[model samples]
Target: MSHRIVSKFGYYSLAGFAGSALVQLAVIWPQTWIAVVALGAIALLYFAFLLICIKGVLKGARWAGVLNFNVLGVDAIESTGIVLFFVVGGVWTCLQIL
Candidate 1:
């Protein structure tokens, strides 16, 4: 009972985090049309996953966890790449301008 409750909490958190990440990426890369279109496609696919999880959570589908874990993996990788580009890429850009 408690585990399901916690999983539900985590599920909502995942949705919120995904929303924030997608919005930030879109805003940050609006000038790049290819990136924007790619994001749109990814967002559509994620929405499908979200719908599936929401519908399956009560029925106890293991596939929900699998999909959630995969989404989080991608999120983690994306976040790490963002941090790298923001830090290292910024430094490199500064060095080049100097």
Candidate 2:
């Protein structure tokens, strides 16, 4: 196993976080201050994880790999849940509006 793979994931996570923030801030435009603040906090947390991943990978630490997989698992679950909501529940999906 190579740390390169973890670094790659970190990069992808960074992109994803940036894209998600763009969508929330620009495209969706959250309706309330609370929502905006919450989103910002989440974005910060994601970036923190990315930094931790980079540090761990660079140091060849086992904890970094573990953290990476744990974060990946959580993301997979959230994505799968959203997709299932649309596909299985016949939900009408729409972007958030300000």
Model 1: per-residue Cα lDDT over 1-98, one tens digit each: 68986775565555445545444554566665465356556655656665566677656677665653443365644543343333343334334443
How many backbone collisions does model 2 have? 0
Reference-based TM-score of each model: 0.32, 0.38
lDDT of 1: 0.52
Model 1's TM-score against the true structure: 0.32
lDDT by residue for model 2 (1-98), tens:
79986785565555455444544454445464465456556655656666677678778797776663543466755543333332222111113333
The CA lDDT of each predicted structure is 0.52, 0.51
Colliding pairs, model 1: none
Judged by whole-model lDDT over C-alpha atoms, candidate 2 comes out at 0.51
TM-score of the candidate numbered 2? 0.38
